[model samples]
Target chain A: MQTETDLVTGPAPHWHEGVSIIDAMQDVLLALIPITITGILIFGTGALLVIITCVTGAVLGEIVARRFKGEQTNLGDGTAVVTGLLLALTLPPTAWWAVVPLYTLGGFLSVAIFREAMGGLGRNRFNPALMGRVFLLFGRTTLVYLAPYLIDFNPAFTPWLEELEVVDVMAKATPLLRVVEGMELPSYSTLLAIYEGGSPAETSALAVILGIIYLIYRGRISWRIPITTVTGVFLLSLFLGQDPLFQVLSGGLLFGVGFMATDWVTRPVTDTGKIIYGLGIAVLVVFFRQFIAELWIGYGGVAFSILIMNGFVRYIDKLTARRVYGQKK
Target chain B: MAEKTFRGGIHLPYFKDLSSGKEIERVPVPEEIIIPLKQSIGAACEPTVKPGEKVEAGDIVGDSEEFVSAPLHTGLPGVVKAIEPRITGTGSKIKSVIIKVDKNFSAAKPDKARNAEEVSKEEIIKAVRKAGIVGMGGAAFPTPVKLTPPDDKKVDTVIINGCECEPFLTCDYRVMLEKPKELLQGSKFLMQTMEADKCFIAIEENKMKAVNNLRKHNTFSNIDVLALPSIYPQGSEKQLIQAILDREVPEGGLPFDVGVLVQNVGTTVAIYDAVIYDKPLTERVVTVTGPNINKPANLLTWIGSPVKNLLEKCGGIKNKPARVVMGGPMTGTALSELDAPIVKSSLGLVVMTVEDSSLDVDDFRPCVRCERCIKACPIGLYPNYLSMAMEENNVVEAEKWDAMSCIECGICSYVCMSKRPIVYLIKKAKEKIQENKSD
Candidate 1:
């Protein structure tokens, strides 16, 4: 491709080869396509409705937040959309308006507080989506326990839920919660398939596997964080005399590790740092689920590990930076 | 098979195919020349020739009593048109001797023997110094000065760098292919002067023919020809030394510190010209090729010859040059004025197109902390952090990240996925450090 060019003058090498942030965001979206399809197949139209509402809400929230700050919204870049989708994928299926409004608030708060307020895009010390989700989760927990369920006391809503014939599933705890309560778990075969015990994104392990393979092969994500995170959980399970396979396959561990914890901005860029960060997340995930779940603290699950580690990411990066080449010891 | 390699280097699209196999074309003597006195890396030379003075080719026009500086020579038999400051291709306006060509030209007569075996160490240095031979690998350090290492240092090996790792520049490759005999004789002269016993002609794996050519003609008992692992910056002195000897030149140290002397393939030929024959440094083979040019070829260009002349001789701009770099694309300076004169060490006149440079089509994106720059850096420097420190105006942080150690290779910027302009930050950081020191 040799054509006469203008007197092009700039830096040395006079060449640039790199992937844009938009390209990487699109690659991430492409990786989740198969998982989204599987979620739709497993949970019917409810999964699609929930995802669509959350994505739309996040985009709207981003625009609203940007407008408030007298800035143009970067909705075209798809970062806000991706954040919303990530939040919705991990959320249990709920009323579209119910999840969307909370997600919208979270999205707005994250962009305003965590990202822009702290520093712009690459400068943020925390992953906006997970930080936003954690903020809402803790806020809701305080509202629920301290205020003693003021909002859920609506009599009309109960009657409507009764008409829908979904009260039984809502009243009884999920299989994982019961297991934490020292009850018998589901059979191994049932655990392997989708039987409604985890988040919307984790419904199909097969789908997540396919997505992770695609993302890793395309160089959009490194295999270090995901593989090492799972290894940490499995190693802890083995030490605790638990079924390592069941501990790893069930819950949202696969989806969270394969996608969420590997978020580029939230993790370390060095190989040593990445491995340490992944292992730390695994230990925290197991600690909260196996031990903290017994106390019925429903605040965070697989996501709690990611949220907690967000604080340590900067420290881990500093601690593990590789010695610069030819640097004398 | 790939030979010895150092860690962390990039593979480049070496468009040597444009002229690697082509023989050097002897450029017709130019009508005018702008020979800069400060072309070498040491102290600037004072003009020795007066305006309107008639001078023969190989005549010294500028020199200094400064021990480190190399003298400048006239490349054509001409009358001095002017003695004034002029712009060189490297973007410097140094004192220059502008010579207008005389129709009937005569070369200076050689008083030294052509046979390399008869030359003694003192004779070699004297001839090299008189000829004003500087390193032709683009550094342009005086070659005679390098031969005399500090007495306390124990020098052994003399590595002749045949690895022209910079892409689209095959002047060194052509020299090795076309002048293997002279290169070998030049290495002998170098060893005799340096008192070095072992000789290793390090060529990259890509030029297997040059390697075989050098190997076949090498008659010295102590010399061995090796194919270096094909990688960008393989021709880098410290990296090349480390690859062969597994020695690390101490931080802020020279190759002589590690008991080795390094010289580029082109410099060796110049050494051969000066030592074996009493020829002064004047002309050098420069690769003038790119997709934008009508014809891509290597030309034996005279010193002070305008780069535009070399480009026109190849085939003037096919369309419009996308970029006209003064050296290799990786580390060369941009040429806005195509008429800038090529000085002593000018390696190539790279006339690349817009597609080759890949500019203006995309904007720089924020660094995603992908660490691709770290992976691609041959120096193992964390460009991500260095760039961050620069942005924050934190010189202290940059120092901790080893900012001074950056070699300005541009590989960090090249492989950066975010197109973060990492090297620019390093340059700024270095500038800031120097400013702080001065304050």
Candidate 2:
């Protein structure tokens, strides 16, 4: 009953809007609203600029990738925008202007090239934003160190990157490193200052908390990874006699745990796997911050831990699967 | 007390205003009806009536080829015109029998009203199977087959899915308001058939009017009316079962695995018709709404009616339709061809029109690994990796990640900020993988 032309069109006659995937993606963007709002409120305008820039970069990166591949552009999916916003949140507030293009390029490479080639979106194991941040940190560490000055570090002065103090930028260590190194705890008020005691992104523990709560509320991400990561860090810090509050609120620990490390794709799927994943990051973060004395590598620790766990997710899922009725494994 | 709402359900402005109060208006029958053979899940029925044969409403035009398939019945008294291939709601092209309605063909409306009396289990089952009733909750899976619990399993509870949880569709709500008695009767019949210990009707708290109306005059004491927390996919059989009975339909298994049978309210009403009047599944109440549909109202449309006919009935297209779906916006399939016929499982025919097409597809870009899809998935499957495995043509990896367990609810696709076609990718993976397995 089939015609010759049917072979070229493929099997089975069907009609679809060719818009199914796009609609699905839109729904995801809408769901991220609450957490994105929390991020904007916490980091102020610097974070907002990062969000806008990252989203724009992500879209542009996809378009460029599609162009390079000689394929039709699907810039309408908003996947790039999501990548941009997520990458922005993970960046240091005082990061150099050069870091924006570097990270955006990295995101395109990881998300558009590697991830897209592996299959775009949900198929990628490594989070694009995290990959972008990691790429920037590793590839141009010198430039990243200079990134905070490129953007307007002074929120009261101009709030735009072009209006910032150029060469007179002051260097500061994150709070987690200070606590691990046995420095006296800065007063809560001082700790909340603009990129002084910690990274601008994680300086405001209050904002991270709000974002985390919003994520949990929206069910955009699970509480298991973040809750377990935060809990593990807090409990492990208590064991090491480090201040739990500093560990919880320091560096990108909150942002990493609340946002990145808990990424559903790279992290293990099973509850047991999630717990292991969280605990692994906690241990690595502590080791990096304390023994290595490298708080600079703390965020990298989360990325590495996720990469390791992503490899072992299959076995972990097998071990954690519920026993099906009337089936012998 | 904690709110049982799940994470990641979108809250769009529900435009259920027009049809919420207006009684369902029966639209005029089309000149010709194109009835798809495989409307329900499982194998498509083989045609029994050949071309040039006269057929009447309730006459079986197609016979079931397998235990899973439902028989096809004529929706109108007409002359058998042609049996040709046509596209279905799922976008799959299947052989459909087209019947041209005879002029002056206002046949007698089958008597559907019934007395408040208990029906025997066997009679209910037989009637439901004969009526070709499927889950009108959009799946259109044969309802009787679902009710018949396996011999090995025991069903003690039947849950009525009144969640209508999908944001825009209000056909269930209109049904609840208009014919609570029929739904209640259908529930009773289902309870009796399943030999259930109890029955529960789960309605969202938002549908206060329907809840109140059902509660005030509800006759079935055995059927407890519980107001469930409003959540997307709460209308899904497994999710609804979890919320009401606290029973989990095991991953990679049917609801019978959990010793529960979930039925949509509309499907229940269809059962009432099947049992009371021997009426075959023909006409169904469809919600023709959304921004693009003008004068939005709940319609009693016949099976095989074209999308254009219904849109025209709803005062034509309000604006340039960005997308046309056969069900709710969340789980509904986008109509690539408006000529596709309305089938038995249709609950609402939605026409969404937004100024920005970006809202439809942001741009198929790279996934940022936000974990939004993972969090939003009620089944807890990792869509990101699964989509990857599918892309690589690695069925083993996809299967390992529990790809088969995916209910295909589109939640992952919906929640993905990257606007990635996670659902489509996964669907393609599932198809390719299944094809490989079969080979």
Candidate 3:
């Protein structure tokens, strides 16, 4: 009985697949659960503290940035939370409690400067979490220089810093860093089980794989990026005469490939472009880990490689553009 | 044989259960009908009869001298009330012949069935044109125009499209199931007219009953029943040719360029009716069903019946519909009002409830660059890049991204997580690009 005047009119395809941006973001957050739990179990309260601080900082940063821009806040989309979780997973758990503020700063930088200022969410040129981590990497020297001054200025910071040193025993040089130093490697089972050396999320390869499976099953991420990235690293490690399994399992390679490198907005949109981007990230990671690890301790090669590849996403998309149907090859 | 399908189509939830099992029944003649003079893609026909003229059933009421157009005939013997502008299902107001039907008038049956085997190609073409038959699969391209491909192009294969890949509509399925022999005969008539060597009756695997029925009734060795994968837009002319023939119709080219001609199965049945029964196209099978439809059904409807009458005949609306779409859900026209009369290309009347029509048209989010649209594009065009270009209103960028090649299947918009109106933007860009070219 409703007349046309009372009804709403839209373009064709009045129905949708019912998958919204919120749904996809929620699926990603769900996929990240296994690694977060594993990180907490392995590194205890320190990992938990880093995650809580980073997520809180990122959410607050997003709200502040949106309010500043006169835009409605979209924190319900869960993108800021995902960015915060990814940034926390990329940090060393045994770092000084000063890392709490630094990690929070990284989260703030991710949503505010890297994401919101660059046009928010999908408009960002680089992976926000990786940009945040890279910013911290660049500022690490300043942090070292100010550490003693900050300790002298605040006596309360001394006990938290000393407590971090006790936890530092469990976080030694990562397997890839040890390979660069020509030290003995952990067994493959131990590495897959709970090898603690690098960032918090890198402690359990099994956990990352579980997350990857969940993401793939949920259709949240494509297999081309993660599979090609791991394959490229394994093959490149074999070419470099390093243990391929160690190269695949060590550092933040799996976690970064599964989560950060495959960030939907920053990565290439085409399938072939994704493969090229993944391989390019792998090449850079192996090259940097092999040659640059000796220069900088705890070198975050995966983050650097992915960030570099992020820069080439537009070019990759252009170069690997699909031949439109019926067009001559 | 393995089922065939083209790449880059989405798996849609085919809500065919709403009306697929219902048998086709004829709607009672309404008191008045408004036959649009132009129903197809080509030129609109001029009114052959003046106002207040008495016209018999199957009498040509509108005709044009244009070769690309078809004549319009009235289904019920009636008095022409007026020749005035009226809104059609496409939301366009064209000059229509509004006829007040005589309640006691019933159409006289044909004298005898003509021997289809003895009918020559030229005769069949002439009969098809005279009968005002057009493609009923919703394109409404004149059958005579399609039958007469350019002399330079050799159309060696005829693909009878029965895929009916659009969700919530099964008029074609019911047609095939109810009129299997006639469909095959009509396909043969099409093959004979086109001088094509072989014919393929392509049905989606979901409609296996129609497929099996057609297969069992097929008497010609040259014709094969092919069950294709049930993917949205699988029934698209270009995609159909690609799936069955593995040959891409050249860019900006017709199916004739690839030596193929695809005709909808319903059109084939019309062809049979035109050729054998010596009848003009006055009625068609339209699926009248949706979540809001109280008694969903496939109704044999007259050409110019108001959509309101059809819905009423289907037991009326159970609740207020969110959208009343004419044709398939994917590429159908959303009717602005129930007063619009059904034209030749209307495949069905789908009344979607709020739960079924879930798109929040105003809540557009930023593109996450998910590439689901790109992967879902049947034409393999980069919809993401094209959408961006269109958003900026850059005609040159849209052209560079092959915006013109987009098929407007709405899969890109359907699969978009951001729910961007991607096809709508591409259509706007294409229109602007055409305007620029003309300027």
Candidate 4:
């Protein structure tokens, strides 16, 4: 007969659903495989190198931040890897080598500052990967200003830039940039097949849809955000007298809606809140793509729109809160 | 036909197969029986039997003048050894009557059975009160008190809750299957006593065998057998009412408020025994099964049998159980010791092994705003927000979020990816709020 000390006791529920943070994070990583492969197939070794560097930097940054906060490192959770891969997929392929340090800094700051500084994973208000991408986007002017001096100081850099063979293939204007520049648009089949001159993840809408399907099948995400986002973008673009198909297929819209905007921690929790947040991002994306793109070249409307909506998630959750059972509406 | 169901409950992996197939074997009377005087939810009963007094199996050991409380009866023919406070399955110390079982005692046959149709409504209620029967489905609320609602409230429908939706619990299902006639007769007595027009015997689709059995034995036109979806809290009173009659009991109210009354199948059977055989609440079928048990089976255990004896009847533990829960896994109380005796509400003894109860407090993560808890809550309250409020010790915020409305079904904690003990925190918050209110 065992004594009472041999028994373990806790709360009423002696069973669990067997889901863990590690499993969920691993599911996200698994879902990103198709899109990551498509990105590599379109942009070659440059995209692969960027993905590797960013993921490594994010993981290292997570360790450093945890150590600094006097907390045990949670490197096995895979959240840092997700942040890094997402940030890498949003960057232009050709610019990978030239801005390696800057993007690495972006990755580091994403985990260390945006995520860990706000008390880590689920507590962060903004999507850390988007915050990282937006950081690099804000520094675009500084890079462009230093481009001439750097070329003059190091002539080898010019030839090294030219050595990127995939650059010539994507030298043509991207579809969304064409919309901004009033250039002729490509056919819908061409866009869906292998669109170039955009971020690595933006290369194939087919790949992004495949990843979304996997996430949905794994029950890691719901259709409330992504479906509402796509519908909202399509109808709103048409309402604004724009080509809805071109708008939906171009830029980082599909990738953002699939990967970044559907982030569990940064988005609203309820179904109704997710729909409202999705539509809110759609409106801002249209406003930024059509109007704000002219003011700033290669404007990342999806990143900014998602971050802005992330701010209102608390309010959205509060407003659309479910009525208590048996309580009248 | 489409199976009836309510929204927001999880599909649990019902481990009923462990004991569902085993016939309920009668456990031999142990050397000692510790009967807690206060098994029901209301006021505690005072001990009526003195130490050294000889008692019969059907003798009343305790009684109370309170209208809400039920009397206590011993199931063993023995001498009262002592009267003291003893811990019960729920982890509360209550005044109890300890009896030493007689070595040479024979089971007494019940008196001639009375016809149910000839009994008056008042007579049925009197018999139920005399039987000291409570809601055997875990709440242990006095059945007679529930049968007697206010005059203004009209209870037209009676729901016989045979859902047994809790995982690893097959006692109720066994009762429904083996004693279908008694259950139907009990249902008739409940409907007659409550003046209800219709009675629905609700069983989850997973228990189609029991549903078919009950339907086959059922002869009354007014009694209908319903097959509901196998959701975790499908047997919960409010959800059961909503799924069957499409009536919503008002907030902070009860099934009686919505012209409905729900009685568990075990309680219904007890009502049958009470009304017909003049038997008091004594032995009940309890499922003693889990992954750690050597022999998982259902036992017809006496009311005051120690959990250790019940476990011994199941061939003892295969390994050191990580958790010994007193009821179903979803809403059961984890027992700290095996000394606590089974009471009126003890439904099952689930002995979880280390692998089954692997939830670690160290692995708890912050809420990722996943809304799984919100979606899984049958009551439709925001469990995540309520958990956050309680964590910060904000009682007002917790109250605003309807913390009191939480049924503590443990669904929020079970489905939480972060493994946060949301229901535990919510329970703490409810306690804090109640303290403030009394202040």
Candidate 5:
């Protein structure tokens, strides 16, 4: 005989909207579209190769790492994709061929060492992509050794690069580097166009702005970090008697401020905490490059500043915690 | 009028349009009714009538000497079938009297006339205790118990919570429109009983027509009909007091601690019925609605009517209902079976589709540290950290994070992007803390 006891009983709330970790990660992926396209348009097939190789390597690393840790791994969540895309975008476009192997190793270290071992996605202490970029930049003689390989390279395989009018601009010792060497800077208005040089994504400031507008419009990302942090850097540059617009639009500051500092897990979650975190990143980036060091070793100041700030996220959260309505201090 | 509101709340889609337009229909007294003796917040009542005894409408069936409890009154004239354990809406089994209707059965008359002006404060309190009116806002605390606050703490304000902020429930809204006089007069009686300085009938902006109707009853100058923002948990006792009085009822404290008292509109009508007419609480308006329900409606039902009977009256269901919620979706108790009887505190019977029960547990993920829960918390407690503390099984850390301050409104869970059950974790931590204190 069978018993009649198959009814369902649960807790108070019986409804939830269709949102999950994968959905948020997917939204971030969608917001990166314009920047990714701008990178391909600026650096031709090199940017495409860097993105595909890093994304593929990072995703595979997450799968293999989680399997080894005996933990559940959801590959379709697009977190790995976001990490890979962001890592590739922050690197110099000239590293497209030579830096692929090093960055792919960096991607594996990111997922295996920083992310999965630190408890995956939301629990990870550092931004996996940024950590991977920092690892390649400082971990070894990789950048120092590979620096000469990109300088002498020809754009023979970049069939799309031959068709663009600004092909003359796609060389080593980028525009930002020329500024660091005390060379004359480009006009402020020209920062929005393709001839501007830094990383592949940083080549077009307009593309990054368009992507940021989407994030702000969709309410997917917070505006406090990008708005305050970028302004803080610009203000500091003005105080130092430097070109403020050049400080804001040039280098990886725009890309880093707009997206990287706003990652919900690694950054402070409170409104005030986010502003403080953003201002700190701005000061560190500008201070490291302008005061402490310059040239190639200091181009990495932004990523280093962000990773260091990630360590202080919990303290910032505690300090800025909202006072419970009627509790005594 | 501008809407009054507190900070930190979410605006969920108020699906009131499903049954807001439908007038409340009555469910005829069933052939057999199951009445739970423990209807209110306190001790269980002793059985007044035994098996094989005949009883009539408005007759006392069970009486408890406990000061925190209220008496139980029989609604249908019938012979006692049996007094035994029966299932209630919360899926808990309790002792209840099973009554079979007489051949010439007549239900209790709810239309007995009332003279609100003649009722004295002492008489009103006595009548409420005799009539067995519990809070119909779903808390089910006895009205007499709620009215009797400590002497040292002065009670100066009375707020009538007409803000039915729950989704898919509209019984309170319909009552405010159909019976504004009783709501106002009953509130006046409560104000006079408690010796409060002023009265506020707070309604959400979504029910502006109800607000206008209550405002038109200009006889009571002290009773002010105010509009509140339409947000989940806006009708919560503490939140209502916070928004109107600008006073916080401290952590782990009652609204009365802030010199305020809140009563549901349905309970106000019951209070009016009990005080003026010398009647007892036997029936209430239970909003029956949902997408799966074939005909959604605000239903005036007997307190002991089975949920299945009410659903059948509303044209049964369009599809297999996966869950039957007792109150509003935000804070209602989900039932295990449809046979559970609607008790005094059961405000609505919502028939949800199988899709609600089909939610996969695998979709739940790590807390993404999105401050959506923080932004949605009405009490300002940090739910994400409470969830984290509970995840790590550190109750001390949970307390430091003000886990005890959470009101269990379920808004955090409602607005969470990662589908984390933040409210559940808070409940767990609160229960653990309480257990530790007792130990």
Candidate 6:
């Protein structure tokens, strides 16, 4: 019979046990549930289609990549599904259905080639969802020139507000555009409407709120990054005399804060680093909306700015490393 | 003063309450004790006691010529059963001497529990060196060499690191709270050996009760209690000095470079025991508690005891333990085998079951270049670039990125939004680059 004995020194742990990365990913997925529901309610079936297409595309891409590389597939972990869902949230609500293949390829490229193939989940420096979205953004821009030949028409050229049905107003006005254009504060009642914004993930502020709360409660994401990001945007907008409410509600702000900016793979690992990352994303978002107001340029600002920040992740970590005990900084 | 801590350290759920306040309990010698020849960081000792030999407690069983190594002692008076190479907690092979306990054998009670009578500083140093003591607070660096600073440098102060700053660790706290007299006596011993003018017992504010206990022990005017802000790695040499003395050990330099020597409260106690009891470093204080265990206590266990026995003693697993970690949450390695023997410097044996399920490993995507890692790094190193460089196998670039400086604390990976394992990249770079240099 084994006897219970107290530990005296030898190695650091007398016994061993720990939680796996798969469990952590599940918590993150649970957190996204609220935001996902909000996006679906506001954008109607289009939002749901985008989420389905992107997630399916990402997971399939992962399976194919792993099979090709002679590695075992792990779809049950739910990471690929979360990446797809996050990518869907960053798109325009009226985004063309063509996003399905483009985002799918992007997700696969990020997760499989850039992430797993390179080093597996925790090793990649770039955010897979953002990378997939960036690919779609780049792909869309290419389609603009080749769109007539490909589809013979462009839906984006149509005035989105005029095309929306009465119920669609809830999804017509994206939070970002409102903040950028310096629009008056929308009432909580208006914000609650499902189809108030035209942006893919921004229409349902209520859904995003639910999502963030879920993420926090589930421990998938830290409260620090999203909170700091929104706080930074709020503070910076105020310093420039931009309406704080408009900034908070505008253009993917909620969606970005709730989901995109909080991606555990791409953000900082230190608490202070997360705060800096949030502040940086906020500052860049405000800077682009305030100064450069170009149609294509501003749409990609968050992704672009975040990409730039990701490049300096190591530097940020060093700058913020806690002072070693018994030593000077 | 600015709060001191290491960057990227994990805030593991410290089940310290299980054993934090309890007196250290000595486990009876089991039917057999598996004593490994190599326990510390340096060379594995050559077995001095043969199989079938009857050895007394405190007798040296293994000795090494390596300067950075410590000798191993027999924890029980028994007949050696066999000598064989076996895997230890670190997953390395070392020669182990197995001794079958005599059912009638009882631990000889220590002669007297008394502080050291003021011996000459030289005599104390000789005793410490002879007893084969090392830093028991984790690093396992030989303690005598640390106490004997270079002749060129003058020492002014000695800081006793009572900051069991790592989460899930309370062995030092137990030493300070229950063995206060010995802890103080150890500090006094170090002060005399180093010829230091003052000694500061730096404890984190989170451990206020332990700090209070040490202060009330009435050791010496020079030995003062300092309550530091609670933070991870606060007990690190550089951070501790900064917290107490406002001094910095130059980067890529030793604590002696800063005119001070830092010792853990546990180490000081070990020193006191070695000199007072004439015992070599054999047994130590270990914390055995986790979510799955029925009981957690600070166990005074003999070195080289199989961890599986300890877990069985703690009522075994309540559920399938997620992973068996050999250290604190941040820096500990997950154990792959239960048969591995525990060695010196085992600060904690945490059975962490609940993980942040959201942070699970999925397919990694491209880095979006968010500087969250940069902002989060306490060491001021850029992880993103280091990772990029590492991905490209640009060891030269990784070096330029200061990849070597990363302590692999997992903070970068912990707070990452994209869930990138920035720590792994840095670790790979460090190991690969160091290998290249060695070759």
- Candidate 6, position B97, lDDT: 86
Indicate the docking level reached by candidate 6. incorrect
* Candidate RMSDs in order: 3.6, 8.0, 2.3, 2.1, 3.3, 7.4
Q: Would candidate 3 be rated incorrect, acceptable, medium or high by CAPRI criteria?
A: medium
From the highest TM-score down, the ranking of the candidates is 4, 3, 5, 1, 2, 6
The alpha-carbon deviation from the true structure for residue B389 of candidate 3, after best TM-score superposition, in angstroms, is: 2.4
| Candidate 2 chain A least-lDDT 10 residues | A6-15
lDDT of the candidates, in the order given: 0.79, 0.69, 0.86, 0.86, 0.80, 0.69
Best by DockQ: 4
lDDT, candidate 4, A137-241, per-residue tens:
767557767674642324365556555544432366677878777788888887787877777777888888888888888888888888998899999999999
Best by TM-score: 4
The predicted structure with the larger TM-score, 2 or 5, is 5
lDDT of 2 by residue, B1-439 (tens): 6654443343434556756776888877888888988888888888999899998877888877588888888878888899999876667787999999875766777666445365678888888888888878878788878877679998888889898987667889989999998888788888889988788888988788888888887877788888877776777787777666556676568888878888888889888888888888888898988767777888898888887678778887666534666787766776766667888888887776543222233345455555566656777677876765665678788777777777777777666555566777777777877898899
Pairs clashing in candidate 5? none
Model 4 gets an lDDT of 0.86
Candidate 1: tens digits of C-alpha lDDT, residues B1-439 = 4457776888888888988878999877778998888988888999988999998888899999999999889878889999888877766577789999886856556675666667789998998999998989988889888988899988899999999998888999999989999999899888888889999999989999999999999999998999877898899888899899888787778889888999999889988888777888999999988778888888998999987788768868876646888888888888867667888889998887777675332345556677677777777778898988777788899988889888888888887766677887888889889899899
Instruction: List model 5 lDDT by residue over A190-244, tens digit each.
Output: 6776644666666778888888878778777789999988999999999988788
State TM-scores per candidate.
0.91, 0.73, 0.95, 0.96, 0.92, 0.69
Lowest-sum lDDT 10-residue window in model 4 chain A:
A148-157
Q: Residue A307's C-alpha lDDT in candidate 1?
A: 68
Q: What does DockQ give for each predicted structure?
A: 0.51, 0.12, 0.64, 0.67, 0.49, 0.10
Q: What fraction of the reference structure's interface contacts does model 6 contain?
A: 0.04
Query: Each candidate: how many clashes?
Result: 4, 34, 0, 0, 0, 124
Model 5 chain B is weakest, by summed lDDT over 10 consecutive residues, at B356-365
**Candidate 3 lDDT, tens digit per residue, B21-117?**
9999998888899999989889899999999999899999999998889999998898999999998887879899999999896568887998977
On TM-score, the stronger of 1 and 3 is 3
